[model samples]
Target: MNNSNQTLTIKEQLQACRSKEETFKTLVTLSKILQRLSSEEKTDENKVKGCESAVWLIVEESNGIRHFNADSDAKLMRGVLVAILSLVEGKAAKDIQQMNLKVELAELNLSSYLTSSRTNGVLAILSQLQQP
Candidate 1:
């Protein structure tokens, strides 16, 4: 288990999981965190396209740093969003724009467990975050 006081980088957190079961557990934990940030009000304007499930993303900028809030109709998709958010949330817009989310995700080794559409959904969320 990760220490509450010690913030781990996304790569470090993902690497901490040694097995598929552990990875799934980590995703579930991330999904729970996302669930707390989600709300029913984020329906129409914030909805993300290209996802098989209904996913909503709300980005709030404070002092040049972006805070991400999101939700999904599907648990797995929510988990995926959580993974994406962990890397980008609280980052500067410029940092978000410069990030190679595809490469970061590849390092997480999620492709083996996720379907093509699910992978695309994650990419779609990353695309949204990259917008100016």
Candidate 2:
């Protein structure tokens, strides 16, 4: 299903995957949903830190709503980024700031799948998004 047509929230989507095989399939689906950007938008200024691979994130606010654009050198990392972005993209800054990322990640079973460094990287991306 297309992202716009997807009825399930990211948490619901992850929660639907009851087994490791299911989770793997979900991750692959998430990865395919990620859209790559142009090289100009993938510069160092947009780069996310604490990640093992190079990850870049850019946020644009329009009419008080935030839109996120991100890219990563690693395919799996890009999928992870997609999962992270699904939480707050198109949300207001206050909403994004108020979000409990740890809780969200836990609900999605992401914390179990990610290494500490990868988790930190996701946090870094969220931090950038929360900025004014």
Candidate 3:
């Protein structure tokens, strides 16, 4: 029954955010975890469409797990991308495909701070990840 033995869930940690500023700060910190794509890798083919800001994503599969590399012109979007990618990166394609990302993001309240356009952008990134 030691509270220390229990780890905080992402939802708990997210709900702990008391203010918009704090939430933004958390997002900026999360953004650091996303792997940046090199200039050459940010080609038109990798670029995610229907986004307000420029975003690029590259997916590679080796064995069964898929690897994700991504970047965004907007720091906020990058943070959002990290949150989304956290669900699928390094996971098998079948596992990722089985996930309902909108539900996951909703559980984390990750989209509460996003505008409609930004949400669509996030969805676009998800769409790219689902591609074969």
Best by lDDT: 3
- Please identify which of the two predictions, 1 or 3, would achieve the higher lDDT against the true structure: 3
Worst lDDT run of 10 residues, candidate 2, spans 1-10
Regions of model 3 farther than 4 Å from truth: 1-12
Q: What TM-score fits each model? A: 0.83, 0.87, 0.85
Tell me the tens digit of each residue's lDDT in model 3 across 1-132: 111111234345566788888778877876776667789999999899999999998888889878788889888878777666666767788887888878877766675677898888888888778766
User: Clash number for model 2?
Assistant: 0
lDDT of 1 by residue, 40-131 (tens): 55667898888878888888888998887788887767776767777776778999899898887777756655788876777788899999
**Full-model lDDT, candidate 3:** 0.75
Clashing pairs in 3: none
Instruction: Name the candidate, 2 or 3, with the larger lDDT value.
Output: 3
* lDDT: worst 10-residue window of model 1: 1-10
Backbone clash pairs in model 3 (N, Cα, C under 3 Å; residues 3+ apart or in different chains), count = 0
Q: Which stretches of model 1 miss by more than 4 angstroms? A: 1-10, 36-40
CA lDDT for candidate 1: 0.74
